[model samples]
Target: MADEVKLYGVAGSPFVCRVKIALNLKEIKHEFVVEDLSNKSAHLIKYNPVHKQIPVLVHNGNPVSESLVIVEYIDDAWKGVPVLPQDAHEKARARFWAKFVDDKCIPAVFMAIGSHGQEQAVAEAHDQLQFLENELKDKKFFGGDSINLVDISAVFLAFWLGAAEEALGIKIVTKDKFPNLTKWSDNCINCQAVKDSLPPRDDLVSFFKMRFGKA
Candidate 1:
């Protein structure tokens, strides 16, 4: 058990889910410690003093914070499975999209949820989705044909984004609207690693609907 990895995250968190997906993709076995963000813990405070967020990856004894940073660590530490491409340009491209999901898409999509008169917020959210659809139309996955770090960062956008779309009573990305991306996302969710990492379909839908006061 000394060689074990421990992931500090709640089950419902999309951010936490990203770390779970990365660990599985790299074939690293880990223990999961679900945390309550409402009531923070000392360990969480100590490891991620800055963010105090879930998804602090404790590999052996060292603690790595931030989902994307943990993912980079996982890829670098383990040699066999290539998470990020070896080539610098490809690596940059991967990082770029990951940041796009992190900085742009997620926040916009999440904010449009309950904002009643927030027209700008709503427009901004759909604009990002449209941009993603355009970028994704030519590629099988965000990072080429195989699932990579970009794809991992984007899985939430594909699935949770759909749920958010439903709960928010909005349709930023739809099958008829963005058919290619919708199809690609369906493919992403079906991958064994992704499928395993996700909690459950009903649970996800229920949680999101509950958040939007539908459940």
Candidate 2:
């Protein structure tokens, strides 16, 4: 039998969604095992002992943890639509932005949502979104006309950000404030692969409300 690809992930997790989008974009076939994060399964822990987190990709019994790492791996392991840019500089730039989204954008958005009514968190997220808006200026997508690693990395901003906004009753990616980002988010969600991979908006909003105790 051919080696099977198994993904252990949580529903409504942005990180897990990133992996799903990559897989769907690559046309990779895999079995998805939804994990209950509140009571993580032994299979999840065994595969990813260090993080013991969802979004673990188990290929031929080899487990790969971390969403971005799994994305790169999927790009390399499959010969489908390329995720990373072909040029060296462009690839590096894509990677830099992906890391930036993970390290900076996601955290800022979460802090803003979690700390609803806090001026500091909201301001911090605004600054970060402004930076992203500037980066996205003059581009249809982060990869320029097509979704790429950077776009995938920023998937949370497209879907989950709206959910956070709804849950917290706060607005961040407004047209007047972050026009570029707002447009990019629409472009991203409209992409067939992304649209297919995304969880329903209402579900995401509910998840955020429960997780953040907002709304």
Candidate 3:
């Protein structure tokens, strides 16, 4: 018997996009059940009662929540097309970078574009981005040659960041600022799986414009 897999998430969510990209990379076949976060669905509530968030993966009745956790689960469950590195140290590095994306980078990026404290926030954001830029000095992807856990985890930087920049009329990621990261992001978003899984760029830009009152 085949395994039953279902992902509950809303469109245009980067966390949700992370799961979708991981599944696509692994070539996993699953049903994508969209959830309206404005009005929570019973299944979403049932699967992720603790957080009550989307991007919940249900495999054969077993539920997994959290975007990165779900990606790790997908990698572990599927042996083919490894989503993480095989080497112990490298795999650990991938996990570390993935965690950094959420713990450090996300907050910095948000603050940089936010209304209050633009000067300090932009500096902090660049500091964080420098770490990533240095990390990608000569690498094509965070996973080295191909996208992996780190790349999937940081998918927001590839697409959503651009939308935010366009809508807010600010440019954080620039060729002069982060050449390597800029190149790496280009490769990531252009990948067939990542491209297919991403939400429409224009829609996301509009969303940012509305939210930040930049429209």
Which candidate comes out best when scored by lDDT?
A: 3
TM per prediction: 0.90, 0.95, 0.96
Query: What does candidate 2's lDDT look like per residue over 67-158, in tens digits?
Result: 99999999999888999999999999999999999889889888888887488888898887787788888899999988999999999999
| lDDT comparing candidate 2 with the true structure | 0.89
TM-score, structure 2 vs. true: 0.95
- lDDT of each residue in 165-201, candidate 3, tens digit only: 8888888889998999899989999998899799999
Superposed model 3: Cα runs more than 4 Å off: none
What TM-score does candidate 1 get on C-alpha atoms? 0.90
What clash count does candidate 1 reach?
A: 0
The pairs that clash in candidate 3 are none
Global lDDT of model 3: 0.89
lDDT of 3 at 79: 73
Candidate 1: what lDDT?
0.80
Model 1 lDDT tens row, 109-197: 77876563267877888788787788787787877777888889988877787776665566666688778788888889888778788
What TM-score does prediction 3 earn?
Answer: 0.96
